[model samples]
Target: MENNIHGKVVAITGASSGIGEATAIMLAAKGAKVVLGARRKARLEALVKRIRVDGGEAICLETDIRQHNDLLRLVSLARETYGRLDVMVNNAGIARLSRIDDIRVSEWEEMIDVNLKGTLYGIAAALPVFKEQGSGHIINIISTSGIKIVPLQGVYAGTKNAIRTIAEALRQESAGLYRVTGISPGLVNTEMPDHITNEAARSAVKERAAQIGVTPHAIAGVVAYAISQPDNVDVGDIVIRPSVQD
Candidate 1:
């Protein structure tokens, strides 16, 4: 049994699908009580049922991370149900890839709101509670796009890079008080590309993902590793991608 994750209360955003869903199941199986948040109520309900059937502790709340209050409520639910929040995974994100000249202003704004501000709101909601407990873990899901900086991914990568910067700074400031980890995953089979309004860009990304995307479970395993570490050891940053990805 993994003692570090067992019985820990973990709240995950974007829990309806992809990385979030995989992480929820993985951690819950390891004996963590998982509180799930996402905009899709029906999906959340189904996931909760699945976890229960598997004899794992789980709950769900309808959440839209673009709204700060939703994040607050998510953290509140974890604490209320489990008595303390052990980990907060800022995994909710959107991708609207387009060249800067395409002038897709609305798409840019959407990425900024969901990808950037949403992460900040999660930090706002969890930091105080983590501080109160004198110990906690934050795992922010980032992307390799932020590291490689490809064309048509300018805005999307920018948002991820911003979170990477913030997570690092928080790690530095928190010192021994809490743990901060940034998980930058390469193309995984997820619904993120579907959010792209640009048809051409969407098609290209989807093709690439279909060819080389790793399983969401792979990323979830990485998250478990970060959280399972001893309290004094912080798994600062993890960048994972397919071996074939350039």
Candidate 2:
């Protein structure tokens, strides 16, 4: 029984920690060659080493998805190292929660840059290669915040929703040329909360995440499941979160 995951080349952004790191490890353990990209060079190197020590093939590059060329380099690295790329996981994101009236313009711009534009850059980098190869998978790590919009998460949700819309459109436009999937996670134990600028918001989010957030491994499992399916079967959208989450 072929699981359909082995021998594939997967390139993951935000691969230094949390869901990206967990996904890289899980997929590599399942026999996929992983190309890891993140801004933290040390973390990427450490992840690569751990993967290698586990008898899995892996490599790393310092990538900031905010830069289009960095994404190009990531995809290029995967192709150059492994002959072809099977998957592109655009998983880098940031969140700065505050009321709309708070008007954190800089934070809003940052989220737009990293979450929205960065994802577009990833798609741009991978689409041509996938088109040439006639097959590839693009997986975006979306957020449930987009689905259940609240007061403080207006901008964050907007960015995620924009990606959601784009992903759906891409899926429809693919005409079986490739696969597109958006995995929406509600709350996972990750460093995202630590990056929030608002002191109260950070504390509240951190405390709630501590209480109910699922481990990154759980989301990693979802990623693996999506990839393990036959190429003809495209898992379009998945929302995985703690069962108790509203």
Candidate 3:
């Protein structure tokens, strides 16, 4: 019933840039109080300053999602500052692409830690809060890489798809008090590609993204739309890709 976003408190992880930052701004513009978490303190602070200047309510916390404790601290901020949290957006993600032959076990571990375990940490922090609140929403930022099987993106895709399954299982267990949504975006324009170490693969993906990657704001629009729907309506899975993408 509280589908209206006005006055609701939303906590977002990885809010320094890309989809997380875009969602925070969009939600705030629509009247939601936003709490942002990311490792980049300067960027988070700047975004907060901008939000405040726009007459929006926002707070920034320096957080690294790799640590479960950081995620706990993030939700604690929402409750301490806003009295309650209505939504949690798990948007922190890292994609380091390499071929299986490269055997970049460390990079593989990094992806699992940030993309998969990071999301689980968000759930661990937010689920109890959601249950206590009686109504809350969890929006997870996955990727279309999971939906499309491609070389070099294997581990990245695995992490994303793992979260997708998590979202679905979480939804089934909600039992009417909570909402879990997985948003899959294809080739987004962001700094994620910077993490790729393989020169050829990095350049290839960058060129492809540059050619077809959509703005983060477009994905923000989708997030807003999903959260605005009536309580009876739950948008389970959302897939967004450029028109030119096969």
Candidate 4:
């Protein structure tokens, strides 16, 4: 844990578990006051307690990113509790992977709502504050599944690719007012795949996970590194995957 994160205020979506949880702990350990956002209140509360016991500052705002107002509350919590928001990590997402032929329209809709639109809502919540502050970071947790598209993962990849594209465009327009980054992680171990509706796809992903997946902490480190950079430096895109993922 570096002092680079000290005194900063970080709000993270999907803070209950996986990459989001890992980032919250890591950032808080480094002295950032973290605001946890997720639908799981118990989990968020537990993490807040853990951080506080470790001499770190933290607060939890139960959030479901599908709701725009929930995201607003999350942003407000960070500012109200810590007085400022230095970073908003759009780490909330769902991957209901399945073939287009399966016609899992409901799952597809959920993915779009949670992964793509949810991320947009996070941006909406934090953008104005970032603009007013004239200095802030928006870190989106994308995926490598989008980079090398495979069957059954089409829609999930599409959602991630959409965010990747959005991050790039945001960076170009931000100028000196803000920094935008897309963190594309590959096959890190987490509970993210529990939403998969297709039995075969779920089994395949589980098998792959048992094979070479890394810890979510690796991606958290990347998020920290991106935010730790100097004001003059902008880390636009970071793709982190297991060495044997291919």
Candidate 5:
């Protein structure tokens, strides 16, 4: 294996926008054959067109990360199209911020499903393919919220942290067979804040994001760096936040 970004087939979930979209563009620009998935079909179609127009190989599928079968299809599409799945980027996540007392049970369940179980499903879908190929990389898009627990973000942070722990465990288990990386991004300018149902929390987060959030491309560069490394080198955990983030 060349272990470079070029000519590698990378599958990305939540790729319609935000970090996933940025990562797909960056990777494809580097000569990667990117397979993108997300819930929004129109957005994904537009993105695929953009990548192809830019002279990069790309494909898109409507993937709801909450559905395990969707993840299987995403990975399968990568192999079927590109001959192999070099990397699986589980970048689909949601942040429904609320104080624990808010008792937003539905929101909590949504977070668990999309953030935690979703990552697990990506792993399950890719593991067999990775084992068969004897080489693969799993990248989980986590959040700095997990590292710095604060108000109204307990459950969201918990879900990210859960995946953080799992990524580490998977790394240890895979060892030489494959690589596992956890990317914990801080306030990034994305649509995540729009998903917050609480008006006050949403406003507050949006304000902070506007004030200090880094561009999604910043995180995409970090992902590119991780994937560009030699197979023997595993980039374990990365914490990317605005310099002024506290």
Candidate 6:
């Protein structure tokens, strides 16, 4: 079988750790030239070194997805390094679980900025390149919080669902010029919980995740499956979670 992933240049945001990091390693091992972007330069450097040591082509750039220019640079790095960008994975996000009554305005803004605006910036950066090339794929790492709304995650889920709606709209508007996919993962063992400011909420989430959270590698595999499909086949929305999770 022809390997659709081989030789493809894939740029991934949030590549420093968690889903992005796992996805980077998985895709690189499959022969994709990966361009990694994240704010953690040290971690990105370490990831790049690990990929190289494993004999996979990879590079890292200090990117804060909150910055539109950073996203543009990330895309440019891919094109300049590999001649074309075959895929863009908007995998950077954050979750600050708090009740709606709490009114953590700053935290809400932060989520909007990172989870929602950051994704928009990624699309803005990649769409032009994809349009010019007449072919590209966008894979967004969303969360199942959007699917099953509960207390303390109202804003976070809102941001995710916003992306869900945008992804669908983008897919419809693509006109076969590009592909868009949204992958919503539920309760994976990642550092996302560490970002939660509410102490009690953080502890509860941490406990729950430690018990039922699947590995980020599982999510990475889903990403690989989406990207490995033939260009003509657009794998739309996917939701993966531990069966033990509610």
Q: What is the C-alpha lDDT of each candidate?
A: 0.94, 0.95, 0.91, 0.90, 0.93, 0.95
Off by over 4 Å in 3: 1-3
Per-residue lDDT over 1-246 for candidate 3, one digit per residue giving the tens place of the 0 to 100 score: 234777889999999999999999999999999999999999999999999999999998999899999999999999999999888999999888888889999999999999999999999999999898798999999999999899998999999999999889889999878888889999888887877888998898888988999999999988888889876778899999888988
TM-score of each: 0.98, 0.99, 0.97, 0.97, 0.98, 0.99
* Model 1, total clashes: 0
User: In candidate 5, what are the lDDT values of residues 47-130, reduced to their tens digit?
Assistant: 999999999999999998899999999988988888899999999999999889989999999999999999999999999999
Better model by lDDT: candidate 4 vs candidate 6: 6
Q: Candidate 5, overall lDDT?
A: 0.93
lDDT of model 2 at residue 175?
98
Clashes found in each candidate (C-alpha, N, C closer than 3 A): 0, 0, 0, 1, 0, 0
Question: Taking the tens digit of each residue's C-alpha lDDT, what string does model 4 give over 1-246?
Answer: 464678899999999999999999999988899999999999999999999999999999889999999999999988888788999999999888878898989988998999999999999999999988888999999999889999988998999999898888888999768989899999988887666778887888877877888899999999999988887788888889889888
Better of 1 and 3 by TM-score: 1
- Looking at candidate 6, what is the lDDT of residue 149? 93
Model 2, global lDDT: 0.95
In model 1, state the lDDT of residue 112: 95
- Model 6, residue 130: C-alpha shift (Å): 0.6
Q: Per-residue lDDT for 1-246 in model 2, tens only?
A: 238889999999999999999999999999999999999999999999999999999999999999999999999999999999989999999999999899999999999999999999999999999999999999999999999989899999999999999999999999989999999999898888999999999999999999999999999999999999999999999999999998
List residue ranges in candidate 5 displaced over 4 A: 1-3
Worst 10 residues of 3 by lDDT: 1-10
lDDT tens per residue, model 6, 30-108 = 9999999999999999999999999999998999999999999999999888899989999999999989999899999
Query: Which 10-residue window in model 1 sums to the lowest lDDT?
Result: 189-198
